[model samples]
Target: TGLTPWLAWVRGQAPPRRDFNPCGAYRFVRHPVYLSFMGLVWFTPTMTLDQAVLTGVWTVYLFVGSWLKDRRLEHFIGEPYREYERRVPGYPLMLVGPLATKRT
Candidate 1:
């Protein structure tokens, strides 16, 4: 809804193309959008096997998709995305601490 306009604005202002997928979960999860959405949904008090499975599926997809996108962005956007990733939490959880810290 409101995001469409904001996304358009961002796209307009984004740097010149350096080749990107523009399809991965990076913008939502690596960026603030999906992280905020997850926070809002986390406390919902409903649970069902089907809903749980669907959530799991989407979560897995987001993780895998983000990994691939990171590889591309690391080559394109370079160090900035890597640095931002370290500072900001991933969508579902804050992957912090020594174990989670990315190694070059």
Candidate 2:
């Protein structure tokens, strides 16, 4: 089990952790926990067609957020987290950035 708020604290977003798994079941998703929680909470039962479109756009934004996080983790944690990323497919895992070309 994971704690969204506590993890956020670990990531230095909040002041500190006060409880365990503060966001309940949303701990499963591994990146940008706040964004994920907001999406899960507000994505459905939209009031209008425009709202539905906005929800779709928001989901895309969350996915990109997760991808950027993975890139940062790879840079920071190095090979260990990169291997984790390779093993566990990144959320929405779309390739949006420049390719790593071979170098001399």
Candidate 3:
């Protein structure tokens, strides 16, 4: 969600702190916006051939991009991001019940 990254940005702007924010929308998933995009693309009532191809390509991109982003976050935020990864489910799993838990 917008608020998640915005909070991170705000934190980064402050002095003597480089913290990981696993709050709000991020409590459920690492990439809530991408999950939302997947839902919008896949849950359409009808899909043309072009739409289907686009959906397939975009889905692949989302997963691959998320993986790369995970690497980047781990490198940038280090242990905290890794610990957050251990706690939160990614993507589709986040949509399911009981998988999401709030962690400080």
Candidate 4:
């Protein structure tokens, strides 16, 4: 986030707090905003060859961005983020796959 609390992490100091539970779409996926952007990039009705190439590049960029974000949050937010990762998928389709939450 590059905010003051995030800056504290860079300085090797504790953040003001570690509470960062996002609501709404976050409940379904760890990176809902990334998923939304991907939808915009991929769901065009007509895809020309150039558009297809652009979409492919953008897809990789978004996927890498989402993964880097997870690593950053894990580094900064620590255990809670790991727990959240366990409970939430990185993307909605993962809800039914290997990283899906285990029932208890």
Encode model 1's per-residue lDDT on 1-104: one tens digit a residue.
35665776788864344443333565434545544544444545896888777777766665666667667767777777677566444553546532133545
lDDT: worst 10-residue window of model 4: 95-104
lDDT of 3 by residue, 1-104 (tens): 44666776788863334467777888877889889999999999999999999999999898788778888887978888878877787764454432332244
Predicted candidate 4 versus true structure: per-residue lDDT over 24-59, tens digit per residue:
989878887888889998999999999999999998
Clashes of each: 0, 0, 0, 0
Which is the better candidate, 1 or 3, if ranked by TM-score? 3
* Candidate 4, superposed: residue stretches over 4 Å from native: 1-15, 95-104
By TM-score, is 2 or 4 better? 4
Q: Tens-digit lDDT track for model 2 on 1-104? A: 26886787789896452332213333323454645665674756646878767767877676667667767866756766554544333333423332121122
Count residue pairs with overlapping backbones in model 1: 0
TM-score of each: 0.50, 0.49, 0.72, 0.76
User: What ranking of all candidate models by lDDT puts the best one first?
Assistant: 4, 3, 1, 2
- As for lDDT, the candidate ahead, 1 or 2, is 1
TM-score, cand. 4:
0.76
Better of 2 and 4 by lDDT: 4
TM-score of 2: 0.49
